[model samples]
Target: MVTSTLDRASAYTAAAAVLDPEVPVLTIEDLGVLRAVQVAEDGSVDVTITPTYSGCPAMQTIADDVATALAEAGFGPVRVATVLAPAWSTDWMSEDGRRKLSEYGIAPPSPPSPTTGDRRNGPVQLTLGRRPELVACPQCGSTRTRELSRFGSTACKALWQCESCHEPFDHFKAI
Candidate 1:
């Protein structure tokens, strides 16, 4: 069975539709976790994914979901590979993903700050006390939000409350 370009694209479409277990509003592709998909001549499918973090608990479930989705779409022997090297970054999240997050009542991660100095050559600098990030309230769009906890419902999110709205919401932390 020779796989054509259409077969690979179909496989990718199937795999990319799998939703994140933690954030159901965003598809794996929208979250930037669905990295690559390839359909072999043998009719087997291969997928490569990068987790949001190294120890993310949702990776296995995500892998299974991708495999299942592809299998259901008539692709057999689906293989989902996890790659941690080059690490996943919040920068990879699609604009649509961020918009969906905001609509889902979770504040999307702020844009990553520009890197300064030569990170490769020098020792890492640690700031002991940093000011709290100014996170806008997803509900009220107010910047007067305070972080309630560093850890939220998940490792990737932080719990925060809006001073104006008095509503507590999860904020997707910038990686």
Candidate 2:
């Protein structure tokens, strides 16, 4: 059976709806990883994706998943391209994505402060009063939590200890 251009486009859209394996709460689109889908004149499908971070081990799996999804949707000769530029930022995360992250036991990034200095020059010297509020626990919704480690299972996340629940969970670090 031959598929029409419109049908192929719709299929790509549907396939892109799948959520990231690591962060199931946010769909690939919501996370801004699914960049573009273009159907070639000969019916070949090209998918563009931007990794959330460099050296992310999940990227290979994500590419494979994209290919599988397109193949399942009846597309042949699917190409997945990884574009790295304009690095991903927590600000790119959608409001719905943030909510989903919290629901999935990962605390979303806290809002940026006006006085937060850029640390590129040197170590950030935050004034005591300018420190951002602690991220609340996703499980108990308590603000009482302490940083266990700067790095969690992934470099993009941090491990935090929730005092109220006595549980250790990963928090999506603010980029």
The model with the greatest TM-score is 1
lDDT tens per residue, model 2, 106-139: 8998644565433223433424452445889999
lDDT accuracy of residue 15 in candidate 2: 57
Task: State each model's CA lDDT, in order.
Answer: 0.87, 0.77
Name model 1 segments beyond 4 Å from true. 112-131
- Candidate 1 C-alpha lDDT tens digits along 85-113: 55677777888999999999999986545
Stretches of candidate 2 off by over 4 Å are: 1-9, 111-133
Name the lDDT value of residue 66 in candidate 2: 84
Clashes of each: 0, 0
TM-scores of the candidates are 0.89, 0.80
RMSD of 1: 3.4
Q: Which ten residues in a row have the lowest lDDT in candidate 2?
A: 117-126
